[model samples]
Target: MPPALNRTRLAWAGDLPTSRAACGMGFVSTPELGHEAVAFGVNALARLAHRGGLDADGKSGDGAGLLIQVPHRLLGGQYAVAALFEWDPRARAIVEAAVTDGGMRLADWREVPLDHDSLGARARETMPGIWHGLIEDPGVDPDEWERRLYLVRRRAEKQADQEGVRMYLPSLSSRTLVYKGLMAGTRLADFYLDLRDQACESRLAVFHQRYSTNTMPDWRLAQPFRMLAHNGEINTITGNRAWMRAREAELEPELRGAVWPEGSDSASLDNALELLVQRGWEVSEALMSLVPDAWEGRGDLAGPVRDFFRYQSIRFEPWDGPAALAFSDGVVVGAALDRNGLRPLRWQRTRQGLVAAASEAGVVTMEPADVVERGRLGPGQMLLVDTRDGSVLRDAEAKERAASRHDYALLADRVLVPVERHHVDLEPLEDLPAHHALHGWGFEDVKFVVDVMAETSAEPVYSMGDDIPIAALGRTPRRIYGYLRQRFAQVTNPAIDPLREKAVMSLRVLLGARHGTLEPEGGTDRELLRRHHPAVPTEYKLLELESPILGAAELARVLEDAVVLDATYLPDESLRDALHRLCREADEVSGVIALSDRRSGPFRLPIPMALAVGAVHSHLLATGRRMAADVVAIAGDAVDVHDVACLITIGASAVHPYLAFATVGDEAAPRYRKAVEAGLLKVMAKMGISCVSSYRGGEVLEALGLGAEVMEMCFSAVPSRIGGVNLDDIERMA
Candidate 1:
């Protein structure tokens, strides 16, 4: 059989750490094209060189790059440029052929002049031959020409990958070009000789000096990406990437496999934004959709703006994390901050109509007298400068412009249907002793965990640290959740105080099919109308739940039409075989797949809820059916906050802790559910995550005792170092 889809090479390396970094990034824009914008960007990079990593030699840096409007003065505007990393003659030939097949003529090829002496020893060894392929446009409108160029680039990339050619196109557009490499920030302009040439001028320039964190430094990993330069890490990138992969079938043909697997979290975000822009979304609209503000609890926002965020939440989860972004599409330049405002992005405007924004102030040196205004972007704020009209838009004006494009309040009202709450008769356990034994509920669990929540409607607090031995080293049997430990933010990424930041935190979960294409095919007016004003299809429906913790009645109502799968193993079945069987069964079902261990008896063993959920979730992802169904775990062993969080982190949509409810009895069940919900939120806050949607499938845990094989089969995306037990050992322990 083929390897599991979620299996990554990083797992075999014994680590699956998430990317985290605070890098130097900025942009400079002018009302008119000139050499000053390019020169200012290079100067900014030099000033921020301290924020980037440097090799032992001091000459080699993490990465640095400059993204600027196409230098019409140097290359002319009649032809579109493809800035490529093509070292091989064969690869260049293949790219030229792709351009020809894509219905474009290769007008000329210009070898990008470079000063090799300026590059460090390491960079020189890894650098590819840089060149610009100028393709003649086929007498079409500007929009059509851009679309055609995108198609050609995608086609060329696919062909190059298939041919095993080491080629990369950093930018391919008539409007913009990129000059970047793996070198010290101060040497960027010196290495790329074109940046120093006066003829290489632009109206806007987005620059970046990367500080390597999760991945090693490479030429292609340098920013700014085709559209943006990012300063902070994407904390929920694992889930974000997985969700995007699940939606591959729904993507436009040209963007089918656009996200590169080897790219950093910043690159992934850029890829998503580029796809949205190519599909007709305004740049600000797409940015707002991806990294929305804390609008759910804010009474200060306009009604339509609140509705806009709510409507967007249904289609996409916020890319929750610390982020400070600077973006431009040659004409309009802008900057934005994530909801948390974890990174600094300061801006200043000169009296000469020069607007500059960077990770730090003073990046673009201007005399104090020339500074017209200076400010920093607050949390969930944006600043845009449109060179065409010389219009400057701050947060409110920019967001309002995008929000007013459609009647979002009406759209949300028509599409988002809240899940109905029903009061069902609670059925008490007939035999207390039998239930306790069957579900592994002990005296400590009832007294310390469940009873406290039942009485106070709050998670139980303990003063001392955990004294019990970790699962792998303990002699007693342990659940799968015990093998994994929750990872919290530290150092560079600050953990949020859940109580203080309650306004930004959310537990809302939307259940049902997501709309496929943002832009419809054929490009007809009717198609465009449907794209902008979307409503749930007649045959489909969406159910929104305020929290993932389900009460007895809520669980029953949700499972009424859900596909129930048995998560119990027969006496002869191995744990691995049972998990595989459960995955196979769940893959065949649509809508909700409820994996329940309610069938566990003296003759059958209950599969650990986390294990079952992780297995089935990864299986569905591998088969590209993950988006088609939601996994709601009706678990017997999931009795605490950590247990529920583990299930969710491994891809469970919602969790019903049946055993906890049964132990607490009917009257206290609601309190128990609320307590669990509160605890779940605290867990998310500890990791600096704001929403449960982004936390789902986030893989924010570290397995201390699980063997590599076990991790690969189940928690494939989670970090598993100091490996110990395998499947057989796990089965024996169980």
Candidate 2:
């Protein structure tokens, strides 16, 4: 008989302790056949729970560490621990014996002292709001309050507590959790919190304290319902913050009493849109407008699909990154990623329909299929595994997986249908009074028709600014980051359906739009109409024919004719020239356009280009990072992004990557990483550096900040763990 799989739950090295989060963040699937599936599920949980790597953004004064759930093999020992740390490699090994076994006494917890002396003493003497209880109780001893100076004492204690929190910091460190009294190991890396429940023991600050990907966690501000985890860098968070801030600056004429507190951008944005939906609009309507899709109009889609596309066309794009989001109202729980589909989100199904996502799949071992599924979403897609719904549902209507191999053999023969621009012929429109057209149309008529139409609206078109879909980003920097952040939640690291389809779809979409030929195969064909790599004309003459059309429709047509095929391939000297032309336009057309790549290597065939790509690829391999961030950061207005692919092969160092499709290809590119890492190490070796030895040898613990991670990695005999609710455990209990 085949080996039976245990119920899916999170697991790690025996030493790592499990952190009891207040809510759920990544994908949560129901456990099916045990072993293979269970292994994957737990890995996802572990990865999601694992702390993130340091922020290379140079923002953190001290480099960051991700103690979440890394494998434990790094700590060499008999029956080795499972935790490991990807650290700065500059710190000293932690003094293992320094950790005491008294279970961190109350004296060690260091509750902040609230002093009522000085300012408070004087203020309470004059003002009523200064001291609520003490003032109410006039007989209370003012001497005690005056000596302690309540607020001051609290601040001091808070500072002291901060040090303790930092000491248990994220790293290659591990912790042990008493889960059902089992010695399951978990590293600091796999310690993500699920904020869907009422605040739990370690989750009192979910709403106020955002986790420090690099910065510090402010428990005082965090509250229940806010999610905190790690993935790639998010450049768009700033933009979203800007948009939310600008929107709040104005009263909107409708909301007169609204006053959003500063630094509450993320929370406010969530609240504002939620309010809109609760007030009337559907979920799609509210989200789409906030996170619009790339504009490539499709005339063939049914109402819902068209509506979804249209919804994308109108809203302001959200910033991009590979983000693994955690959200809740202290009730509903969920997570989502950017549309580029970089990063990975995973989950295990349980009795209750909840989903968890993270950067690694093994974090949750019970459910580990990497292929795409309903609970597993593609780019530009949202997985809605609501605890309330008891089933996983796709929120935005995503294109179903294609049925047949792309007909690339006849790629040049498809047709294009662009949406006609919104312009009325003056002569004909003049004859009809615009105001009079509304003649007897009552508000009820519009509402009634819309409601009825909504139910029967063949396609799934949501309203604008309704839900902040991860589809809002436009550039490579944004795309890479968006995918990382979004899919990190998919820790089981499922495949992105669309990325696999990019090449096939690219040829098909281009052939149809550029050639102006129509060939409908199935329901999803309409999706091509919405956005295909722009239609390309074989020659200048064909380009002229489609030149008259404007807006996304016309643009889509032109894209087929002119869009860059291998966006990341180009010669060094010619690189600047090609990028200049690509970023420019033929008069009215903007250089901003769709790009496609096979994640291939024209660069490998070319020496200079190959060298560049080798460097970049090498860096990604050694560091387990991505190339888009560096490339996008360096790309100017007229820059050619193709060179970025070269960087992947050439430069070596760690960076968070956000790649998908063929772009999303495999778990990662190994050879490229080897080249990048070897090259980087060679350079570092020149400085006489190696891991923990050599003339350049440094202290391992303090220098590298690997204490927590070390504990985890060493935890097989002493595994760290996060003790919290997992979907399977909850299911079994239920």
Candidate 3:
């Protein structure tokens, strides 16, 4: 069996690495098409060769690639070219058939020239046959031609998957082309003869030298994905992918199957960007909406800019992490950074109309006297150059342009209603002892964890590491939280300082159905504004909160128009049955479904909070109702920060730790909530994530002793190594 298949046979060996990467990426752009641009890009990649990994042979690199404007001069203008890796003749035939089936003519097939002798031993063993298939133009505009080509590529991909034929399409676009492989950065042009040809001229080139830290390196995984070359990792990729999957039904018809499951984090980002571009969004505008800055507390920004980011946050969560991206769409080339600015990207402009940007400053050699301007991208900044009009827009100008495209302030004002704050008196619980026994709280929990947090408004610290046995080996049964472990950033990516970077982090959450993106035919600004106004009865009302912690008054406000579902199982009912019942009940509602475990008693046991939240979340996603309702967990078993974080990670939008509040009493309740918020921010920042919206549904935990069935039913997509107790054991323990 292949390694991919064999790894799934045992639970302990099934976990995949977090897929983080530290790499070198850059781009070169000119006012006019020229061979020098391509040469400059290759030269920049060679300078960054030290950033990539080398095989034992020392000749092969982890991965390297170049994305350039379509070489119309070399391929002969008026045709769409597809760069593909098809080793099997049958797969090649299927690809040709897919082209013709889409009502296009297959004009010719050119075998891409390669220097096989230059490849290392390991690279030669895995190299696929490279070919370029030219499809004749069908007398349509360039936009229509690209759209048609996209459909054809999707058809070929689906057909190949159905036939079990291995094939990889690096790119199929009329405006851009990609050439990449498993070779050293210096050898990229040496291996691909087209890069050395004078006719392969372009105005823009995006290049990448990959260093695979978490995932396996392969030829198909090389960068300069369809639209961008990315450095660093997308820490919230798991949650991003999940949300994308949930919102598939709302996507335009042409973007139904846009995201490929086998693609890496960078590739997924490229797919999403490509989809947005195909939907008529400008490249810079789409990127701004996807990776917005920290506008919540940035009073320096214009009101419109803040409103634009606020509106975008409701529809899409930020793709948070440490990222420095170089991207292009043939006509426009640019670079952007994430809010944390964990990666470096520098740019320089020369007097001769040449603009070069790279991970380092000296990649493109130039005379100091000829240098007109030079700068580096700060956190959440962008630099764009438009080849069409020979225009350059820095961070401020680019963002203002994007913000001015629509009346976002008006749209946000009409749709978003802030949750009103009010104080509510609390009474002490009369049966505190019985409640403590029922919820599995020991005296030490209050003395060390709860009391300390109440006094200091922060998490308590311990000097020595934990000495107790893992939950699987312990003599006493533990809560479900104990069987899971949290993952943090390592060498490839740096963990953020939550205290120093608190300004960039956010705990804000929104409640209500998300407004779906406009369809391709209905994307006018007027239509968008009309769709979000208060007069529109079809639009869902949004309730915004500054934090996920809900006090008594806030909880009452949330429950006024919300559906409260019991998260308890009767003596006769199975845990699975109770979960399914709750999911069914949630499916019937449209906004704010609250899952409360407060009803658990001697006659009924509470379903584990993680299991219940994960089940309902997965079910709603499958039923296409996940975005229609927000999930708030009213948990009784949650007393610590870890428990609340676990709940949110498994799809809880917010958590109300009723038991923690009851234990700490009223005066300390506010302080306890504050401590939990601080702890949650620390947990998120440790993984390099910046916001609660991105952290929610991230499923970053690794289950230590969960059974396969339990994982599949309750914790789908979460890695559970070392499978142990079954559902029956969990139920008995509960």
Candidate 4:
């Protein structure tokens, strides 16, 4: 028979952990110290218990977990102790089978002795199944064997899961051990017996007390996710997940196809980082690659630093959003923040070599004279401690080492190709035609829209709030982007102020297909520090498209040096097919335009601009040819700021609403451009993104009624919780 089921029930009827910012705290002392630090860690959790969420029952917490260095005596057998209680014969057989299957030999299974009779009702009710297993390994290299042991644990857990057995791995590494549960932070120590034992000690302990936005709590979804604890959200997680899927061809079958735990964005990030580390990347380098600072347009940073980020950006888009994280690999402990400093992380150092960090100050108390330093983690900064070397590296020192590891500037200059642009000097737009009747719309309605723009040029404001049904449910056909709405920071995390914090924000973007050869399928490259080689030459023109609101003359001038695929005359070819062919055929396909020349009731482009761009971008990525060109939307249907922002959000680098230019005339183009820019800024500012590039291809949207299949194709991983219109509806609408 299968192993007995022992999973925590999914029952949550209370406030979520994400309703407010989470409180994550860590305590680490030098020299592998014991109990004193472990006690401090538990005390820290108890002090911050109020930050955790409470359910309707006011007994269960949102979730809490603690990670600490593995006790050497436990694995070294110096203090070996026999089993206090005999393991069941059936359980032993299952554990042995799992261990053998994972390429490890099992020595013995021991049940952790617990006095359930003495436990409080709440602790007894909320506890999960627990056990301690020993592996047969001769005294050998610890790091190598421990890594293998970790993988073995993972594989064994996967096997157990398939047999309907729920294995709760609080900790599986020789270097680290985890103790966690679905209990209030204040009760974590009481529920996990190890925490209560004074003899159990460690030099480092990281704790996380979660408060998710939605109150539906699952015990398995708790923080301190195996490797790290993250606060704040990953807004670009949809696109980030898509990129990970695209790289599946280069991963092992189990890793490529394994089911991810249903946690928050932080869980996904930890999974990715684990994979990268298993592929030979240093933890610090992996963190930098995943969440780099604003470097593209900054001249203040060293050339090597800028080059490092520029090269990494092509391979991985920034996990852009507000975030603060504390991570550890048993020997190395660290913390980092996102580029936008929307989350708080404060740290204090004691003279006796203890460093404590948390979301709030005073979580760990120390005497005034004992305090060596007190500071907070800034945007894109990191703090790392290496217990092996007994050294601590702050942001600058850590980044400097990462940057200087390779000649990124030389690599970038040799293989990085930028967009090409032609300089056009032109007078302000003037003497335009009265094309108000072009689409058969009344001139007065057109005038009213244009007049409102003229009046609101200084500060565009909207009086009519959006309350209509989404396109999937509406009677009138709408653009594809209309089906998805931009999701912004809510109660859990704070949003950035574009005007107040422009220094850290960037608008620069890089467009074109990647140039490097594909990494080998189902394999990892062990050369983590080698210079990157591009399959194609990296040197190309850097084309910066500010906005799509372009005049005909300006558009013509820019196209002189570009290979333009005119949407106006695709002949018998589908736009998607044409764009794909262009990407494959051209040596340097820099730009694409979706043009609408029809001036009748079918005023919209045959293909909705958003759908066209999204389809093209998704196809290019699928075919391993996304860096070929930038998509431009020269649409007639886009006039208001909403239309333009929608097009850009979907995938277009820039959008030219030429119809608006024609209707408003040349003299009004500048005013119209200002109004549109202001409006787009307001829209983006709502989500706290400062620049267009960060927002570009973010897939930071939620679909109210879009079907799953279409969303998977054009906007995969986008949150479309409420399924609605299918492909049939989309085709009919189009």
Give every collision pair in model 1: none
Ranking by TM-score: 3, 1, 4, 2
Residue 231 error, candidate 4, Å: 2.1
For model 1, the stretches where C-alpha displacement exceeds 4 angstroms are 1-21, 252-254, 367-370, 420-425, 517-538, 572-574, 722-724
TM-score, each model?
0.92, 0.31, 0.94, 0.78
Clashes of each: 0, 236, 0, 24
lDDT (Cα, tens digit) per residue for candidate 3, span 95-115:
789888878888888899999
User: What count of clashes does model 1 give?
Assistant: 0
What does candidate 4's lDDT look like per residue over 608-714, in tens digits?
55555666667655763455556666665565777777766677767767667656555666777778876777667777665566577666677877777667656
Off by over 4 Å in 3: 1-21, 252-254, 518-538
lDDT (tens digit, per residue) of candidate 1 on 616-725: 98888888788788899988888689989999999998998887888788778888888998899899998889999999988889998999988888888888878889
What would the per-residue lDDT of candidate 2 be over residues 204-244, giving only the tens digit for each residue? 11111123332332211121111233233333333343233
Most TM-score-accurate candidate: 3
Quantify all predictions' global Cα lDDT against the true fold. Answer: 0.82, 0.26, 0.82, 0.61
- Judging by TM-score, tell me the better candidate of 1 and 2: 1
Q: Once model 1 is optimally superposed onto the true structure by TM-score, how far is the C-alpha of residue 393 displaced, in angstroms?
A: 1.6
Q: Least lDDT summed over 10 consecutive residues: which range in candidate 3?
A: 1-10
